[model samples]
Target: MPDDVSTAGRPHIDIASVQRLAELADYVVPFAIRAICTLGVADHLVDGPLPIPDLAKRSNAEPQALLRVLRALAGKGIFTETEPGVFGLTPLAQPLRSDHPVSLREAYPLLVGDLQAWARFDYTLRTGRSSFEYVHGMGYWEYMVEHPEESKRFDGSQAAGTRVEVRTVLSAYDSWAGLNSVVDVGGGNGMFLIGLLSRLRHMRGTLFDQPHVVANAHGLLREAGLTDRCTVVGGSFFDDDVPSGADAYLLKRVLWSWADDRAHLLLSRVREAMREDSRLLIHEPVSFPGDSDEVGKAYDLILLTMGGGCARTEEELHALLGGAGFRISRVIPTPMFPLVEAVPAT
Candidate 1:
């Protein structure tokens, strides 16, 4: 078939190319969803459908504007328009609910928070510096630290995300069930340890992160009935000590936020916390040739824009781990990133 073929005496057309272009340029749907999530629109409609005026008032949004956004999202099957001016929840919109069993309400906004950074992606492409810093006048971590409320929300979103990723990590690694104890370095709010210790009844764990981050871990661990089995410690992974002598030390979804030097320093910190027999388990997406992981690719750019980081390949990981004085014992592949296990070199 020709790239463009005439039909009914009209000019040649390429529907596939047109579709690809439209897909690339489409941003309205995502932005609309982000707006709704940010405004707590879905949470307000939990009781039942609400007229646009009531919904808007509840969400502190303009009635007409909220109606228009809902109408647009309804067409995309996000929310439902039972009748004109009345909006209700749909199956697709359930996760947007803050009270839902699985909530992504916080993640969406945090993902798209720096729209200005994304708009200036060319700056990252040209200079290899963080567009987030360029746009916000500070790096992502500094901004988070300066803004306590936003930092808390970011921690919420990360803990929520860890809930979903925990399944992947657990199912992909059978050795977790066998471990007697594990330490979750940089573990936010102890979600991962909660899930792990809940299943492996005999296992004890420790959750380590910054002071502000681990402050919530105590209550959460208590609520999960894991307080007795898990210890919470507060410190930076770069300059502070991690809990040592656990059967395994976990670095999950954490290192990708930093460039190689910081990442190496973090790994070395964890290295100092490990015994010779202790396993260092790193859970993150690793790049490789012929890889078509769009999520990983998108994250590579997200990391670049936010923090001047990029997804590393297995070889890059090997070098980093080696520099941190560990040897890769095995690399276990998973549906997402492979779990790279290492042990102390000497």
Candidate 2:
């Protein structure tokens, strides 16, 4: 036998490489779960396990295909095949339910909605441009406006994240307690403003975004019992002037979607709207100094391929704010992201 051969004269197997290959093959799970989510399969399985044919009938999926999907998911521990052709939810699948406490029903769709766009993500890496534009022949925001149904799902996803942000800002930043009024620049559907004003009963807010986006905000603001406390304005923040002279101006989850030039323009517009006494609050996902910021890094890549934007570091934010004629007063760290408070540079 050759020295390189095993005792039985067989080739040695590389288990690590095999494991890596298996991991790569696991990409199918995301699309599988996305299909399950789109079909509302988990919703039907909520009460208990059902046979494949019945589950398919309820979910509007083909019987054999649903059985295979269920089996594949069960292998990954997301769902269970209780018997030959019956399936049920595992604890991990609960969040996929629309009525679950921490439902990801909408978020999953938003995450995987750009299925085709991602196919051209390599083009973005090659040309440093948006794959979304390449794939759809339109920018991300433009596509959202043109497709109202997708835009609604995006809003629903943001609403869930906004609730977390509201809770974090209230507990982490003390300055909000003293501000009487704030303006939310580029606020989407006014979810953040609604949450903020609802808690800070003494404080009021102005929600500004595109006309189509703001139209939905009015009903939500009213539903939150903030009809009298908040004002909704519809206009492009870049083309139109921001609401002027509020106690604070908020750019929450807004700045990450543009390149430096456009981000600078937005900051300058907000700065122009600010008075000497006005505080500018930036609530965004800031990329920290270490490898610990995996989520921040992932979001940065999404911004890169989805639009021509990036997640800024603390230093990057400092430079951007300084360039926009503002001085950082404080930085409040939160589990969600960072809240950077700034004042007009004089």
Candidate 3:
């Protein structure tokens, strides 16, 4: 009889059980971290290290419960206990601070907090429909349009992720050098446009998005000192036309929000407005045909849950663009996102 197997006087353990336990344990960590971020623990610790009781008082949370949460996070190296009963920030936790330019505080809550539509994610897995649609009885975009506060949180979360990638795209693509004007199609909150226009002083930009989304962009453009170089336009991409006479048009993290049919519609609209020589840049995660990378796979699920879309392989993108009258001209790699430059085939 094997020592690992159960006899009348012994017990058995399986490796599968260990794997399952680790997976379940991993699930609890995100929710716990979300609670701390939502309670502003990182923000409270911004000035200096504090004891658990002080943190509890400032956050209006019970000392004992908050201590347990912090202790768990410390185990994960998010924070450290430098002295008995006192906590301090760790390098990993710095990004959680609200004042950080690329803070993950908003992203944390958006991904795990009370407003997370994925709490009912089982509904999505079972029905093969979007969790946002299943839980809210509407699509993510429709839900955002209906709830202004939630929309703001969603936008802030997106902006945080975009800030990291915007600079990478700007530096990687050489197409911006001689362009006189650029139009950002479906540009949310205008972060990409702001980054691009800020870099190229002589270039002008037009930001096009839904009416409510574009409303938020106006203030951002002004804050970026780009008011003189940018224009904000509001309309649906499905029904309305894109701005004409731009030398470059960009769709950053945009097309993956819809299925192929709708994506084709959007590309068609951009093609109609583009001059024969205009450049079209599509920035997104280029999923390889067989490789399984974490962000690419997780984003695949996020797309399915938030909307009925999927990330595409390079070949898939070529087909998608070709079907809509555009052809791939070059593939530019950045540290974060890939830039696919296309042009009108005819």
In the predicted model 1, the residue pairs found to clash are: none
CA RMSD of all predictions: 3.8, 5.0, 4.2
lDDT of each: 0.84, 0.85, 0.83
Backbone N/Cα/C clashes per model: 0, 0, 0
TM-score of 3: 0.84
Write out the backbone clash pairs for model 2.
none
lDDT of 3: 0.83
lDDT of 3 by residue, 141-196 (tens): 67767777877776667777887777788789876788999999999778888977
Which segments of candidate 1 are over 4 A away from where they belong? 1-13, 47-54, 110-113, 236-241, 275-277, 323-337, 343-346
Please rank every candidate by TM-score, starting with the best: 3, 1, 2
Q: Clashing pairs in model 3?
A: none
Give residue 126's error in model 3 in angstroms: 3.9
